[model samples]
Every structure is written in structure tokens, then in C-alpha cells.
Target chain A: MSFNVIGKSVIRVDGLAKVTGKAVYPQDIYMDGMLYGKTLRSTVPHAYFTLDTSKAEKIEGVVRIFTAKDVPGHNAHGVLFKDHEVFCAQKVRRIGDPLAFVVATSEKIAQKAVEAIEVKYEELPAVFDPVEAMKDEIKVHDGTSNIIYHYKLRKGNIEEGFAKSHVVVENVYKTSMVDHAFLQPEAGIAYVEEDGTIVVCAATQYPHFDQLEIAEAMGVPAEKVKVINPAVGGAFGGREDITLQIHLAIAAVATGGPVKAVYSREESFVAHSKRHPEIIKIKTGADKEGKLLALEAEIIADTGAYASWAINVTRKSGIHVTGPYVIPNVKVDAYAVYTNNPFCGAMRGFGATQVPIATEQQMDMLAEKLGISPVEIRLKNAFTKGSETANGQILTESVPLITCIKKVADALEMA
Target chain B: MKKRGKGIACIFYGTGYGNGFPDVSRAYAELQPDGKVAIYTGATEVGQGAKTALSQIPAEVLGLTVDDIIFINEDTSITPDAGTAAATRQTYNTGNAIKMAAEELKKELINIAVKELGLNSDAGLEMKDGKIYLKILPDKCITLAQIAAKQSEPLRTFATFTAQTVQIDPETGQGAPYWPYTFSACAVEVEVDTETGQVEIIKAAHAQDVGRAINPKMIEGQMEGGFAMAMGYVLYEDLGLENGRIWNNKLSTYIIPTAMDMPEIQNIIVEDPESTAPYGAKGIGEPVMIPVGPAILNAIYDAVGVRMTEIPVTPMKLLQAIREKEKQGA
Candidate 1:
């Protein structure tokens, strides 16, 4: 159906406002008597540290210094697993771990106060590899094993299917950790209104979720906390987790005045979650006709120190391990393991971006081993309507792989 | 020495949170006393032209011009919960809700026009270009302004659209994860510098079956932006963590592709309208980026007889692969 506006390329609604500098972002928000907030992060990765804030408290412009002890409500918050401490009490698990928070009259004073606050630490042996962390020896989070979440998918009899195969190929694929790299570093402003409502204006993807999490952390009713998102510079998924929402609210409520916090570029990197680094061990077996017979995979992802969206990412990785191919027999084990590394959570593609690099390469290798062209091999096993995936989901509509392959092939030939 | 080659990859993405996450959108439509229309919904516009597309729905349904509609959006205190503006659902889910609300308000206006103009039947009364006309008479009509001026009652509506999605089984991961899916294909040409180990993307051709293009120009913009980001993911961008700490903490240290690094791009839009979608449109935001990285990787292999399995295929890795291949051949 033709549409007057649906298919037309109309300009963005707020383009003029954005270009004309009329658009107000979280960083643009300012209030009278607002204290600039700063955090003192741990210098050592894993250690028990005692924070010395006596000298910093004597800073001329410093309003107040807060630690984990000053938190009136729960001191912990996370999206999937509430294991991260807002402010470390004694032990620091990662380099970005917050030891203390300072609020001062200016950002310059807050930075100086943060520098004056010294910390002493006794180092502990830390595990950095996800595979080693999976051995259940060095527990990243106390009590719980290093392996935070494990998911598996099984299909038809893999042994029987593999026995019928004529060729088998195995490969180990690795992917490094990456950042969202959104243009906007984390920034927010918080203040308590006259009606006793805590208001947080920030650049975030999800405002309602932020409000609830802040309310829960402040031990206030959900109605008492309001989160208003201004023009987000870019989210990609880094802003999905709490950056400075709860910390800003704590500062505002504690000092009984408005407070603003903006993460420097360096702080933004350590504070927000990163894409999980992965190790995928995959083996594929196919018949003489180049049809996939059996497949097996073991995917280990370093979720780093905390569980943000690790469970969901692991599950998605496991589900998409088979890629777009029609595989009847398959067995997959995907795990999100914890390590004393920078925490990992959501990125643009989450786990979807990692597994495809391996699976697609596996397909190319299989095609070469079978003495068939890449296009021919993929066309042989491309999914169609009524086709069931390794995870048992049936494709009912919009299965256009064959058409896409043909189109691309034609385009390449023409070029 | 430099060699050039081409490769292709395709991807299909599920739209919305289809795993039993109750997806719903609400919209409010009210025809004002001055003959202007107002739309209220909590759909945030994160630089995606949501307000433009949403206003089009009410304008098309009510037979009014887009300029005549005023949008009040993204305020939680005033607008109803239209769900999050993620998963590209604002155009489909929220657009449908606005259409329903506008249709309801149009019906109320037509009924008043019928009563005020002494029309024989409601069937002959039609609203077009902000005027109600009797189809049989053609000239016997009443303007929306006159209708509003004679309003004995309020003209407004509130409507909601809840997407029906199937929950996948937890154990098998089977079942319909989403209501509908969007499809895309990408073909990339690369020139591999064997000596320097640098791969230059000469050109890229991307085709997306958007089910329907809600806004063709917007879709093209999304394609260009997604492809550039994917180019960075495949060749240049890496977080480069050292001992759980960021090594390249600054933009100068962490390199992303500048405009000089961009390749020539061609975008092709395929329209196979989805029956259940608003304006028969499926999302193209996430699907456009999925196939690009793999296509670039495959193109690198095509250029040189080496397969680099990892991401951000760095120059050093490519040089090492070339050396390994040379030693094996020797």
C-alpha cells in the first residue's frame, strides 16, 4: 500500500532544535547550589583497601565525602545480579571499583578532593582468564562460583549423526572485549524538589527502569523518584546499566541540595559495561553431499567481575551458535564466567556479534574442505519455511536467505 | 602487492521482545475547538523521526494535513505509557495505536457533521482535506472548524494496541520468538595490501527487505550509519583492554574510522509488506548492521587466501596470516 508519509523521507522532528542549539541534554542542566560530584576509584585491581578521607574532608570547597557506610539503603545494585557495590567498603575487585565519593562546590575542587583521598591496599591473587575462572577455584564473587550463568541447547542424537559424516572440522575462535564508544560520556543531574521528590535528569536509554532502580537504592517510594531523560548523545547499550544515577541521587538527598555528576572519558570506560570477550570451540561434521550432519560448540564468555546482562547474553549466544543454517543434530554449551576484569554486559549486538564471526568462518572452512564454492555450500543448507533450527524454532515467514544469496551473487557478478 | 575480491553475507533479525514480554502501546487523539488535532503518547524520539512518522498516521487516517496536527510526546506525567522506544517499535506499535485513536475521533466528528448538516445517512458523509462532504451531492459540505464551533460535546479518543507474541520454550529455545522478522543482505569489495596488511573496503552494496519502508530516506540514513559502525567493528574498532584496565582510554588512542576511511555505499530497499505491521512495515534498525561485518571478513578471505577468524581484523594479524601462508607455500 502506498502511503503519503510512511515511505517518504521526512526530516527528523527535532533536527532543527538539535542543530540550532535549542535542544537541552543532561549535561546542559544546571541548578543553583548544585555540588559537583566525583568518585575515587581503586588503583589496584584486587585488594582490601582502607580509604583515608581525613585530609580530603579538610579541603576548602569540599561539601561532604561519602563511603559505603553512608549508604542508608542497600549498597549494592546490578541489572541481572545485584553483586556490584555502589561504594567499596573494604575490598576492591576491579580497577574501576569506587572507594569513596566526594561532593564539592566545583568540579575542580571535587577533583582535588579525590586526589587528596589516599587508599592503602593489600593485594590478592586474581584470575583474569575466563577458562581458568570457570574451574571453580578462584571465586570472583564471594560464595558463588566463578561461573555465573550456564546455558545449553541439545538437538537430535549427535553421536549417531556424526558417525554418518564423511568430513569433520574443528576450530577455536576468540573475540576481544569492546566498548560501546557512544559520543556521550555518562552525565547526569539530581536534586530533591520542594515536594520531597528526588528528580534525576540524565542521558539514558531507559528512564522508567532508572527511576525504579534509583528509588529502590534510595529506600524511597517509586513515586518519590522521577527520572527524566534528555537528548541522549548515544546509548548503544552502555547507558542501559546504572552509571551515575544512584550516586547522584545519594549526593542530592544526603546534602539536601542539587548535585551533578559527569563521568570523564576515562571514568566512562571503566564505569560502564563492556562487550564480553569470548572463546568459542566449535566442531562441524558434514556428509559427502555437503549437508551438515552434526555440530557441537562450547562457548565461554568473560562476563568480568559482575553479572549485568550476562545471563541473557550467554543464552542469546547459545541460541545463535547454529547461525542461519539448518542443523538437525547439535549440542551447545555457553557460559558467562566471572573474572577480576572490567565487567561486561550489553553492547550494540550483545552476544549476537561474537558468535557469527566464528560460525561464518566455520562455514567457509567447511565449504573449502568439501571442495564446493562458498555460495553453493550455503545455498545447500540455507533455511526455508517449515525448517527447524538446532534450537527447535520453526521458520514460518520472512525466510529469505536463498533470495538474498541469489541477489548478492548477481550483484557481485555484475560488478 | 594488493589484490581485490568480493563476498556476501545475509542476516535475519527478530523485532521487539517476543519472548512473552507483554508489549503494549497507548495513544490519545483529541480534535480541538480550533480544528487542530493533538496526539499524546510516551514515545521518545531518539533522533529517529518518530514524531514525523507518528503524525503521518493520524493525518492519513483523519484526512487532515500533517501541519494541522500537534504532537505532545515523551512526557510521562502527561502522555500514556506507549512502551520504550527501542526495538524499532515506535513506528509499528505506536503508529497503529495512533491510527486507531484518530479513526475513533474522526468517527465522532463525522457523526456530528451528519447531525448538523441534516445528512440522509452517515455513509454519504466523508472527511477529506479538513472538510466533511456528502459524496452524492459533492458540494454540500461543512468545514471541521464549523463542526468544532457547533460542538455540543467533546471530540476525543484513547486507544491501545498490544502485540501478540509467542513465548519460546526455555529448555529447547523453540517457538516463535517475535511476531515478524526483518531480512538483509550485504556484499562488500575489499582491496588487501599484502605487504602492509591493510584491507581497504573499496565499496559496499546493502539490500534490506524492510517489509515496507516507513521512510525511505530515513532507512537510507540508518543503512549508512549502521554500515559505517559495522566497518569499524570488522576492521578498526577494538576496546583494547590490558590486565582488566583500558589501554586506549582516549579517542586519539582508540581509533575509529573517520570520513576518509569510509567506502562508497549503495543501498537497495525491498518492499514485501508485512500483513500484521503498521503500513506493512518491519524494523530495519538492527537488521541492517548484522550482515556487514561477516561480509567484510569474507571479502578479506576472498582477496587473500587466508581466513582471519577474530574481529577487528588488525593489520598485524593480517600480515602474520600472509607470512604463515607464504612459509607454507615455500
Candidate 2:
């Protein structure tokens, strides 16, 4: 069981090439006869829009201007739900929706052409709040309910358990929308090879997933398109979803040459997904000795314009609502709602991050009511070797919450 | 006016895809005629030291130095799928596959060495540093060069390791969602500027159960890096949005912690080896950031006697909380 290098610190194999500035990112990619691509985004949050590219087609050096009618195959794709449009055909549900794409010989020409393209938009009522969206008065998407997904977890009887409680605390918590803010703005380049195969090199987290999605959108087989990720500046779950992969593929195939698109910092913020903004309501009850008796939680997440990872986030929120604590009776419901807002998806913590702010605060509240210190209350309710989580999984090993808290508490005391 | 206070938070994180996803990592190892090794996998480096940790595993198992290992990664057309480098599964799942492939190649080499040396049993033979030596008779050794020189075919093997987990109950959200979990706790000491509502982090300590440290220095880098990112998430970073559109869309408008903003960090690595992982390593990439925001929030509460519930607890927000508390007292 001895190892010479398994546990030893060795120099990174790719460090020298990166530190020496020899790393070739997707942005650095340049091919002869390449066309720069630019997207015209919707100005209004929600509206029915009609695009007119006749004026833009006359712009000098503009190769082509493609709209929703120009897409070869499927115009929509998403990580979880295929609701996001490559080019909006009728209605723009979010401000980031792509209305048209411009391909030109130069970036300036493409941008200028995008600005020249005329469009008329008829505004529609939009719902911005998840709770209000749940009312379904103004649905983000027509025909379907605003609630994208709802998950429920039922444990022991909440009524009986709450009746046995000596103290109860109720609270509501709100988490703000945060961007990934990765140093590298979303960038990619795509081209159709001589062999009629499409190739895409981009800053992405999942190349395989990107390949399949890109191929499907371009009306080609998965093998026809290849995705390669060069040196990424940073991706704290920001690159998990599709960025510029498909847009470049469509432009490349349509322009009959290499196509490159790099979002500016402002466009990058509007283009990519952000961490889900959620509102969590929690109620926890405990006995006089600080033994957790009952827990009830309802988490509503603003999934924004699409259901990218909304279902996954809501389920995870339901699973970890108790926050490393042991409770007998627990009931939880998590809902993801569609809204005409900035779309939210995976981030570093996923669903587990926001719920902790509520649960931990609830823990501290219980501590105050029980006349015990924060450390004592957490230790009292901490899951041990044989404890069962709110998700009903029995802990077998490596359950070290108590030990870790004690060490941190001890370290803080020493400091 | 400045006052000092401390707070602590502990949290658990799972490693691997979890949620009953078929999480698998596959690796291919081949021994070249020149005694070097080549490993092919789709694990992206992503500045996470994946290439280094992955190289170390095959090198350790095949009795070769890390310099002898060549990695072909990040190219889907060539490398086998090792699953994405996210979820901190590189060292655990991919490490196991690389080890298996290297061990398979080593078994073949040991058989060849036994036959070449005219040894009676292969049990006494051990490969170390590109040479096969008899433990009982160290002088009787054969180099990999000699074996490859006389070999009929090159040695190559493939391995795939799948995480063992159960699907959770759809309604209850209960089951073996993840194979193994990583636990981490962070404690922070903060000084609050009562007038300005700016909290200064004096020192911070983070202790994590990584199951095992494949590379202590790299794990330290992950800890400190996660701390810095989480610090920004707590105190500085916020994507200012108005009416569903980003207001501070540029980095110049948004704020993040620079080198000068980092506090003194005490990185502690707790090694509790997991039986299911490669060399007993459970990944620590994500767990390192889970408890950080809560820890700093608790510390701010302790210092200012106000609980700021939202993230990016800006100075203005703290000043408002302080004023609200004062108004209540008045």
C-alpha cells in the first residue's frame, strides 16, 4: 500500500506551457478565410419581434446575415430542457435571446451589420419574481405552467413531531443572482473541414455534451462535429452549460468558412447562465435539550428564462435542507419557476449553497432559544456513524462533521 | 471603533456525479519500446493539477517515474472518456482506472521478467525504476529495455472504473446518491470597523477530510484557492442586475478579491483514507468552498451583533444593518 508518487507533490505537467504564455486558447485561434460572427440580442425582456435584415445585407464586407428561418435544423437546445432558442423566431422571452446573427469579414463589420439590422418588437407582459411567476398570470412561456419543476420529500409525521417540540423557529432567506465572472469571456471558433466535418474549439467544461448538442442543432450527426476545449481561464460551473458552441457551428456551416465569435464582457454577462436566485422558507422545532424534533422547508428558485438545471437544483435543495443535522420528522417542497429574467443554472455550490444560509441561521436560532452555544447545538444534532440524513441515506463512514466542527471551534478558541 | 470576533461552520460534500448517474472514468496505458509510458484519458487539466495527479498514479503502479508518463487528454477524438473533471472525481475515479491499467501492464512485464531471468516463481520479482529485481537476490535484475528489446509485442492495457452508488427514491430523495463524501470546516477571525461597516478578516483556518492527499501541495493550492473564491463570494462579488439585465457586467464595475485582499490562511489537511478510492483519496475540490461563506457570515455576526443574511455583504448593507440595530436600541 506504499506509493512513491501517488501522494507526493509533483510539478504540474502542463504548467510550463501555460506560464510561458504558449498556451493557445480558442480566442487565439485564427484560420484563413475566417468570418467574424455577431449576435443581435433582444432589447426588451419579453416581446414578439419581427426582424428585417434587408438593410444589413447591403452593408459592405458583410458575408451573410442569418435569422431564425436560416437555421438548418433545430433552432433550440438546452442542457436539461431544449427550450432555449438558437434564434428567436417569434417571441423573445428574455433579453439575452438571439434575434439574428451576422457574419462578416471583420469584427467591426459584423458588429456594424448587427446594429444596422432593423427589428420591430411588440412588448408583452413579463413576470420577474419566482413567487409571482408561480401565480401564472403572465406565463414566461405560452401554454405551459410557470412552475418548471416541483419536488417534495415526506419523512415522519410532521404534525406529531412538531407537537413534541418545545421551541420552534420560522424564517425566510433570499439569495441574489451571481455571475461566474470567469476571466475568459465566452469565446469559440468553428469551421467545416474539407472532409465536410464540422469542428468546434471552445472554452467549455463538457466537450462530449457540447459535441452532441452542437451536432443536433446543426442538423448533423454527433461525429460530424468535434468540440475541443483549450486553456480555460476559469469555470466555476459557468461553462457547464452551452455558451458559444452552437452559434459558432451555425455560422461556420452557413458561411462556408471558419467562424469565430467572442462575447465582450457585457455580452458575456448577458449570454451565459448565472447561479440560481432562490427564496427559502424554513421552520425548525427542537426539544428543550436541543434535540431537533421536526423540520419543514419550502424552497422556490427563480430558474429564469429556461430550465437549464432547475430540476436538479430544486431536488438538491430538497435533499440538503437540514444541513448536516439529524431530524426525525421532515417535510420539504422545492419548486423551480420560469421567469422573464436572467437565466440561472449551475454554480460552485449548486443547490446545496443557498439552503445552508437558512438552515445554519435556524440552527443558531435554536441555540439561542435553548440557552446553548452555537457549537453545543450543532454537536448535539450532528449526524454520526449510524445517523440517517434527510434524504434517508444511512451514513456508513467518513461522517466527520462533529470532529471538524470541534477542531474549528478549538482553533477559534485558541486564536 | 473595531471589535474582534470568531465563528465556525462545517459542511459535507459528495464526490462524483452522484444522483445515480453512471459516473465512470476510463484510462488507457501503454508501455513504449523505449521504457516510457503513455496514458490517454479525456480528463481536462483546467489548472487543477489533474495531469500531474493522474500521471503520478500510473507511474507509481508501473514502477516508473512521472517523467516517463505522457498524457493525451482534453481531445475527445483521441482520449477515452474519463468523465468531466468537475465534481472532484479526477483523483478518485480516474486514478483508479489509471492504476488498474498500469497494474495490468505491470503484471505482463513481471511475467516476462520471470521468464527472462529463468526464475522459478514470479512472487519474488518486483518492478522498480524500470528494472525487475528479485527481492531475495537484488543482483539478479532485468531492465524494461531488455524485456522490450526481446518482446514479441508492445504492452498495452485499458481500464474503466465506475462509481458504486444507488439511485435515490424519486419521491423521498433518499438512497446512496454518491459513493463517498468529503467533509470540511472553516473558522474565521474578523475585526469590524464600526464606523465604516467594513469587516477585516485577520486570520482564517480550513481543515478538510480529503480521504487522502494524492498531492499535499496541490490539495493545499485547492484549499487556498477555494478560500479566496469563497471570500469574494461572501464579501465582494455580486452580479448587479436590474430588471433581469446585468448592470455591472464588466469586471471594472464588479469587485473581486485581489492578492492584497487575502487574509492569513492556515490550511490543514486531514487524511482519512477511503477504502473505495485510488490510494484512498476522496476529492476535496468542491467541499473546500461549501462552508466558507457561512463561516464568514457567522464571524461577521459575532463581530457586529448583526446577521447579514445575503451574500456579497457589502459595506453599505452592513452600515444599514448597524443603523437598524442602533435604531432599535434607541
Candidate 3:
């Protein structure tokens, strides 16, 4: 199509507003009658707690103090499952879980009121490893086994392929949990107006997704709950699931006045999601010619107290286990087990990021055994168009992968 | 004492699923009684040249200069929703929507001119700088103001579209869910220190399938910014949490890539315009950084013949790898 602008460089829409400091962030959403809201979180990772909200509510300048009971609709909010509680009523499974909350006329009052609130806790055994948790001695969530989801991939012939191979290698690797760490902490202003409509504004990604989830938690119609996104600092999939959105709506409906809640940098990191830490074990068999015959792999991921996209992450890791290469025989088992480690969900690079790190290392190892260059071994196995991935799906287009490998090899001058 | 070695990484991401969400964007061009065209759209400019690319679409469509048009509408109350300005879909999706709006406005203007003049000439009419002209007749034309005053109806245009994509099967994680995946690959050169295991990036070149460069300068910005972020991911950024509590929450504790940590980057564009996109654009935003970390790790191996195998390839890990290699030699 003949065009003048679709592919042209234009100035940004918010360049002037951001650069000149005119852009109004959520913290800038100040009004004449706005109250500050703060949650009282548990100090211990796992404990049984009973929180009394009366003391904080009776404090001077303090408004209504609420617990899990104050929630008009669903008291708990989570995307995949209804396991995580909005307010800790019985057990504080993780250290960052909110046990109670206080609302006050001033931000200082809110901070003071949170300190006035008292909680009694009995520390319980906390599980941090998925391998031990999967034994089901202790449950992160009640009744169910500690496993959220287990996925398996079986292809070609594993035992026969291994027996025919000249060399076999087995090793275990671990990938660490990382954070998105967007500049904007969890901050939002919500109020039930005179007409009884709840307006919530915050800096967030996936505004529509949060709007619908907040509606369900508040027992309000989706239209009545208008979630507006202010200027976002950054979100690398950190805001995909519901966070403080439902809590703000609840506090607003209970207080009957404008209420704003913002997490400090410490709270944002403690409460927000992180990447899953995976323990990957792999046994590979290859011929003397360096032709890879089979791969036997098992991976376990710590899904934390609730299954927050961790199962999907492990599945993605399993799918790309062989990397961007062709493997005839592949077997992979992935388990997303519940642990008391901090809740991990989505971050940048999603799931494929983890697999490449492990598989690429294995490729380097195979090259060492075969007395070939790392780039040479990858070029031999790199999937081109018409070549099927390990899952047997045809790659209809985009054979540039070999070229991608070649370009890097040429740039590195790897001989 | 610490000495730094250069490192490089390369990678890219799959474009979105074509489940076809409604991408309805509207831009109107109102030719004033005097000689001016004002453009309007709901495309919110969130720092990535949405307004500039959008304004150009209308100007190009109306056969007018870029300075002659004003694109309006970021408020959801006034403007139709153009899906969130993400995945670099604004220029491609909203730009096409604006062009359609301008074409519709031009069509109405020609119809009004024909009605007022009582001329049944379907043969030749084109929009040019505040005037609608008849190609066949030299003097048989009218200015846009003259045509609007003589007509009863207001000249305005609208367009709504959906950008569709398919999802890869959950089982296989294979699908062309994208019209075309925005592909970018990079090769990084790094120098690793044998003693301290500090890595430094020396030179880098990124080759990307930019669909078509909507804004060459903006594309370069995305490339360079992605380069820095990816470098941070591989070398510096980490969320140091201890026992579910963030140990390093503040900027002082958490490290991001600084200007001093940058490598010389050569950005290359491989344009294979998407058939379904506006001006054939696929998203160029997130894919820029997706492939970068791997490419840098790959380069680290090339320099020292060691597999870092993990993220934020710290000096401690590098020192250990060097020690292990020395022990094997012994």
C-alpha cells in the first residue's frame, strides 16, 4: 500500500509530558478528601495468625480497619486458581501475605495505624524445595498434593537410542529466580463516588485484564469498575495477574471515601512476582559422529504457595529442551511443585529463556565429546524450514535460524 | 584487582497470537472553511512516535503536508480504543486505521462537491492541499471551503479493523500464530578477564526483520535501548531476595546497565513487510531484547572457551571456571 507514515519515525506521544515532569502518576492523583491505605504483612514466611483490627480502627484519624471479612464478594483473588487469600485469615503461607489493613486520613496516620495493629502467630514448618515438597509431607495449599501440574514429553525411542550411542552424559543444572522490577511500585487510587460507581486508577500493564478480575472480586459490574492506567514506568509481565487492584476496590467500597494505596520499593519486590527457579536434570546420548540420538530430561520448578504461571513456565522449558535443534529421540518430564518460596509468576523472556540456557550448555558439552566446534555442532542440528522441532510440528516459515547461528559464528570468527 | 572482558548475546521472540482482537482506531480529517485539515485518532502516544507516524498517515492520504495536519484523541471518552499501544502495533494497526478514515473523508467531500455543483462527473477528482480538483476540466474545480459551505452535510471519516493471529498448539508450542514473527539475531564480542572473571562487551551487530521501518530513527532507538536492557539482564540485573524478603529493593542495591557498560552496536534492518500489517509492520519493540542475552553468553564462550551457563555471569563464577580449567591442566 502507498503510505506516508506507517513506517516513518515520528516523535513520541509522551515525550514532552515525561521529560517536562508534567505527567501525572498515580501518586499525583491527589484529591481534597483522599485517605491512605496500608496493609499489615506477616514477618515470618509461614505461620498461623489471628489479627485484631479494632485497635488500628480506634486510632485518631483512622478510618475503617478491615480484614478478610470486609471483602464483600470473593475474599481471595488469583488468576489460575482460587488458592491465595486476599487477606490472611488462617495461615500466612508466605512472608509478604497481607494479614490486615488500616485506612487513615493522612499517610503518616496510616503508617502509624499499621504499627498499632497486632497479630499473634505460631511459626510452622516451611518448605522451600520442590523436590522435598513433592513428597507431600507438608502441603502449601490445603488438601491437594504439593504438585500443581506435571507434564511429560515422549518421542522417538529413548532406551534403544541410548544403548546404540557411543557416549552418554548426565548432569543437573539450576536457574535462579529473577525479578521484573518496574520503576513504579504498586500504587492505585480508588473511591466509591456519590453515584456509587467505583473508579480505580493506577499505573499498570494489562489494564483490561485487571479490570475484569477486580470486578469479580468486588461483586461489582465490570462497567461500574473503571480501571484507568496512568503512565507506566515498566512491566516485564510482572502485572499480568491481579495484585493490589482487588484490595484497593475493597478498601474503597468499605471506606466510602477516596482511598489510595502504594507499595514501597521493599513491599513491591516482596509482594510482586518473580521468575521460577528450575532444577533441570538431563541424560543425553550421542554417536561417535556427534549425531545426537536421545535426550532424557526431568525438570522441577518451585511454584511457591500458589500456581501462578509456574506450570506454564515449566511446560515452556520442556518444549524447548533441545533448543533450536533437531533431536530424534526426546523425553522430558516437568513438575511444578508448590513450595513456601516467594510466589513466582511471569517475567520477561517468558518460558523459552530458561530452556535456551540449559540446552545451549548441553550443545557445548556434546561438541566437546565429539571433538568438534560448538558452532559446528549447532549448525549440524539447527532446525531449518521444513525441519520439524522436537515436538514434530512443521516450521512453515522462518528458516533464518541457521543463518542466525551462522551470523554469530562468522562474527565471532569461530574456526 | 578486577579486569573486565567483553560479552555478547542474541535472541528474538514470537509475535502475538492472531485470535483477532478488535483493533478499532478512528482518525477524522475535517477540512476547514479556510485551507486547513485537522486529524483526530484515539491512538495514545506513550513515548514511541505514535503521533508522528499517525499524523503522517493522514497527511499522506489527504495529499497534504505533515505540518498542515493535527492528530487528536488520547482520551478514551472521546476516541475509539486502539488496543493498548504495545508490541509496537500502534504504527502498523492505528496508522492503517487513520488512512482509512482520511480516504472516507475524501470520498464524502467529492460527493458533496458533485451534489452542490449538480455535476455527474465520476471521471476525475483527487484531494490536494485544501482543494478538490477535476482532472478532466482545467477550471471545473472548487476549494474545500467553497464545497463545504455549499453542502448541508459535514465531511468526516471512520475506520475499524481487527488484527488477527493464531495460537500455537499448547502441546507443541509451534504455530505461525503471527502473520510473521519479528525476527532479530545478534552477534556480540566480549573480553573476559582470566583473574577476576569480569566481562566487557566490545563490539556488537544486531540484524532484525523490522517488517518495514515505520520510523528509521525510532527503530534505531528501540534497537539501542533493547541492547542496553539485554546487557543488563546478562551481566548486572538480579532480584536479590532472601527468604521471600527483598534484600536489594532500592536502586543502590539493584544494578542496571549504565552508559559505561555499553558496547559498540551496529543495527541492521531486514525488511520483510507483513502482508496483513499497516505498511507491512510487525511489532519491533519486545523482540529486540529477547534474543540479546543468549547472544552475549554465546560470545563469552567464544572469548574464554568457558560456559558461564547461568545469568548475571558474575566474576566469582568466572573465577571458579578459570580455576577449574587450570586444575584440569595440572
Best by TM-score: 2
B79-165: candidate 2 lDDT, tens digit per residue: 787877677788899989988988988988888888888888898788889899999999889988788788777777999999987
Model 3 docking grade: acceptable
Clashing pairs in 2: none
How high is the CA lDDT of each candidate model? 0.80, 0.83, 0.70
TM-score of model 3 vs. true structure? 0.84
**Residues A275-323, model 1: lDDT tens digits:** 8888999998888888998889999999988888898778767767787
Clashes of each: 1, 0, 25
Give each model a TM-score.
Answer: 0.93, 0.96, 0.84
Tell me the deviation in Å of residue B78 in model 1.
Answer: 3.0
Clashing pairs in 1: A6-B214
Evaluated at residue B323, the lDDT of candidate 2 is 88
Displacement of the residue B174 alpha carbon in candidate 2, Å: 2.8
**CAPRI tier for the interface of model 1:** acceptable
Give residue A199's lDDT in candidate 3 (0 to 100). 76
Model 3 misplacement above 4 A = A158-171, A282-297, A326-328, A368-387, A402-415, B1-12, B17-180
Best to worst by DockQ, what's the order? 2, 1, 3
